[model samples]
Target: MLQNTLEVSVVKNLDFIESGVHICVVANQVVPNLAPILDRNLKAKRVVLVHTADFLQKAKDLASAYSNYQVKTEFFKIQSAFDIVSLRKDMQRLFNFYAEQKPLINITGGTKIISLTMFEKAKEYELPVYYVNTDDSLSWLVPDVESVYHLEDRVKIKPFLTANGFEVVVNELPSSNKLLRQVLDDLIANIDGYKEAISQLNYYAYTASSSLKSVSLSENVEGLRKLVGLFAETGLMKIENNKLIFKDEDARFFANGGWLEEYLFHQIKQLGSKIPKIQDNLCAVEVCKKTNSVKNEIDNMLLCNNNLYLIECKTKRFSKDQSPEGGVSSAIYKLDTLMRELGGTFARGMIVSIFELSKADYARAKQYNIKIVSLSELKDIKRHLTSWLS
Candidate 1:
């Protein structure tokens, strides 16, 4: 209960100013450095990012985020990440320039040597020092202040991504249609009943999208009629004269395994309501990294407890027997890379599949530290999500 459950209030006696605060942050992970600026009560005027050469572009991206938040940013580059003597010289110069400004230092980021150098220099100069923890607490460690304050959840999806050197070029928010939600609930409740039918529907949907806007099923497949009727009730599809007619490409996409994406996005929103720390969520987001032109489309992304959760909803069927180029393994690899690239160490990646995978694929997901929630888990999704958030 140190800080995670301490989203209570600000410190009472030790009052902080609302302006003229200059914080020099050890820039490695970006969010910790941006915390103080996001707190309106602190009202940071400028932020001096102290980063190594490797993190130069990330630091610049963080500067852009500061500019977006109306806080100016400066840079202090270190020549070496681990060389203590070189880092001390650089820290000395940074401290000399920032001394007159009475700037503070945050040791929440950077390598251990860098943080140690910055901390020792701040103590020598008798300047204030701070550190941010994952639990959303700002600790004032200088002069044995022993004070910690809970940070407000003021971060948005766009700025958070921007600070991490990624840009949200295109985003589409989820629509909470009652009928669509009902269809999802029905599918989950009757998961076993619709498994085979949904698989056939996926095939037909994919074939239709590849060829025509519709498909004529000559044979009345078992349970397909009922499943199509559920989708038709949600206005997602219709059966006309032994044919499954999709409204458009979007409708076809939904029919062809896109429903799981829609389902998971809404499920996260529902989880957000019960979990107060859940902040922002977006589905169908296309983000690109600024340093390199690498692009990735996120099926669903949620901000909870100051951490981004990247979720990939897959309705693609997985085989019981293993193959070298299998669906689940590929999904695991993609989720692992995207999570590390976009969210760094502060993010969690999850793959929610409508079908379970083989033991080898499950082990592969575990190796990559990706969470897998499949059909059985989806039955008690809220409970599973609660455990996940915990």
Candidate 2:
């Protein structure tokens, strides 16, 4: 049986003589038992085993066991096996020799190198290759390729064929063929079902930070920071003294000058347009920086006719569990005082926390009719703002 396999391998290589093929027989140290399979079926005049230093002892043991085999099997140490440089050099040498001698079987050990270099060289030389895996669990060979067969289940044929562009088929193979497939499938299915039933089921949803890291902040804060960074990346803002400042890059800022006021009013306008217009023509004012006023530096202020809006912009960093209750309360007090000074001009107040907001803070803002806009939500706001302005 071994002789017949060897004859077939040799015949296949000869058929592609113009390609000057090199047969790669790959095995792992854990599966030293696969050595004989390569010895029996590969009828090449010369065979080479690409073994890593980690598997040298196992290769020697296998070599000693098969000392009586008629085929000459030589071992080549794969220096820095994982390194691309070493693997490429080894593959070049192997392919160059195969071009000259047309070796029947060039067995490579381990999947790491086999999947990378050896397989690459086989494709380059159009060589007939076979993988000898020690693990009897699942087939790693390319699916549907008759030339590639697993030693454990030779009868179970792959659904795909062996070709240069065969990765598409192999990638599509059912993950059930993997050992952990069942566990993963069950977990995902349960999660999906739970998510689907969540809306219908009256369940109390609470937000908590993962214990994996300290200084846990809400996803909102993290997302806003990322957006700020993206704006900086696009040269819209510059970081100075750990604060984001609008860059004087374009004259568009002259029309929408104050960053915070412009950003908030734009969002309110966008949201109001989507919802029913409870108010008329939008008006915005910057009151925090008013001279002689004891109010905290207000980011932006908006007034839609008689409906006045006060906005407090904060780029402060806070974790998921941390609430900006104190900061927000201070802003509300300042805005109230400012509104009183302006003869009750402002009707609505808004706290634009560019960072994550704790569940408590979010609920608190909702109670006061103050909208809480997260950084991720701001992206959608900006997209609409562009369309509205355009």
Candidate 3:
């Protein structure tokens, strides 16, 4: 019988899985099943994935990723996962075919009925069955409980998303250079001085992009000369005839606020020094589902302990020149939509911008449970991140 008292804290090394045994799992949420299979100590074996109609493509994608790691995989399908009687018949047939192998069942990914039904079948067949706890520990059920085994495996963005039926089609990681750091830090420290200056730079840079030609700007413009010189020293753009000239689209992008994304990416990585699993910090990440025509590009994102944090960075989008006072609500709407579509349990959505949001938009963001970090918040980003990430 599965008991409520089946909790253990002592880390137990799980070496029970022997060579060449077929490991079975349901494909509802693939990460839980992968906890043990992807652990460093576990050797390659055939993973048999039992999935419903909803997860067919995801199962295929997961199978491919597993093959890359040299683990063999197979699939079983149940037309309706909630159809208990038909599912039991199907599961019985599946078990009989693998009867010789006596596969292990991972009761980690399905509805209560699905897990309960599988557990009943495992008990009947005297097969080993275990559940993955919230802390990534394994709890044995069938064949009786003994200990909870802590999983050494921690998953990154790609595998986690793939397991959840998504794939990263395009990923542009942040740059690891001091140039961006200087520009970002200076702007953060003197936001007041650089506020209008950045907006002016963005205007000309956007003009250059619109015309497909380099636009000239005089550094002699009052309140802009000092900030322009800082950017000039960074070689982000060139100067001619006492004016700044954007050389290409890349420089234009930087002036038009690409640096904000880069800055947030670095600050997120800095959290790694105090926390584990920070290598998945990414910028300009585009993801798509394997079975659909849907796709979204995240400005900056990171994965911490399986929870995805999606952030949208903006410069002139919310400014009065580009949008009306309540325009932030629309961007918040996009973030909220992405969060609901991509964010699983414990996931979060946030908007970090150079401009402060209007009170109405701020209330709307609060209503959607999206976090807001504006110009003032950027200065103390470390503190805010520690709270949010922790």
Candidate 4:
């Protein structure tokens, strides 16, 4: 009986012939999956990417990440992509030449027909066939009951981004920004009764017409006066004669840009610091992305375990009658774009808003793999952050 299960450590120790290689028939859209396979020890002398001419640049980009290993590309015609017969012939030809060296085949990507044809050939040649699971882990596809092997590491986010054509700026959290942290901790500590009040206060901060002018607390909120007092007590802003005043730049910064972002950033940093076995977890605030053609910014980017957690902060209220063009939807769109560009499908997105998301918006967020942490979840953000990374 053949041993169908192989541990990652065992697989890495396998000896490869001088000309042996790992062949992957990949498409432009599925190029992200290639990273995991390459990250794991495949016991191959080199990597041969089978892709179309349109994805040649992407293939080369993928190749650049593995400088220690030889990586190269071979083009196939797009018109013949779904033609299984053509793919089979190509596989047969490849097998005829590489059979002596015993190359491994990964049927993890490409069109359905392409994958099917590759599967057939892998079986016919009695070759090793593998697939990368959704979580960027590896497993065998041919065996009825296969052993699941998790690679010890994943490609880091910065390299992954650079390889995928994103020019990223590494922005570090300022060491001198402890005042905002103190204020944020105070706000969360004293937020029991003042949830709505804090939200309403944030509204005022966000909408204040001028930095010099004190913004009047709305009279309609049930405990509007107490909320203003709490803001003053927390040292977030000054209050006199029932108007909320920004005493200095820090007060104005938290009020307008959002205390919610500061709070979440604080929690995220704390979680990353205390967590165990995290390869690399770093926070970058206002990290800018510029390629040859476009420019965009991320509010907070958490890079951990070679995956990206993109967080966008919002302090505004979302409408019950949610439209695709509404604030909630726009945030999701922005996060999704950043994910695709920066981390491909491997990136996870999150929006932490002091406001609540409507049912429609929540469902839309779930569909796009964008997690939402709204007003209700603010109290237990640490748990949410832990579960999100887990």
Q: Report lDDT per candidate.
A: 0.76, 0.40, 0.71, 0.63
Error of 2 at 296 (Å): 81
Instruction: Please say which candidate is ahead in lDDT: 2 or 3.
Output: 3
Q: Candidate 4 at residue 82, lDDT?
A: 67
Rank the models by TM-score, top first: 1, 3, 4, 2
lDDT of residue 301 for candidate 2: 39
Best by lDDT: 1
Ten-residue stretch with the least lDDT total in model 4: 9-18
Give the C-alpha miss distance for residue 314 in model 1, angstroms.
1.6
Candidate 2 accuracy as lDDT: 0.40
lDDT by residue for model 3 (1-390), tens: 333333333334544444454455565455576656776655548788888887777678678667655677888887677888887887778767775676777878767777777777766666667787876577877545557766664567777677666788888656677876887798898875677777777776677775434455654456556666777767767556645567666667777778888888889888888977453788878899877968888898887765678999887747343243346766877887777656555567788877776676667677877888887888998887777776
TM-scores of the candidates in the order shown? 0.88, 0.29, 0.84, 0.68
Could you report the Cα RMSD, in angstroms, for every candidate shown? 5.4, 27.1, 4.2, 6.2
Task: At residue 85, give the lDDT of candidate 2.
Answer: 85
As a TM-score, model 1 comes out at 0.88
Give the number of the best model, judged by TM-score: 1
Q: Please identify which of the two predictions, 2 or 3, would achieve the higher TM-score against the true structure.
A: 3
- Tens digits of per-residue lDDT, candidate 4, 208-239, equal 55663456655686654565555555565766
Instruction: Please list the residue runs of candidate 2 whose C-alpha ends up more than 4 Å from where it truly belongs after superposition.
Output: 1-41, 104-108, 111-114, 133-144, 147-390
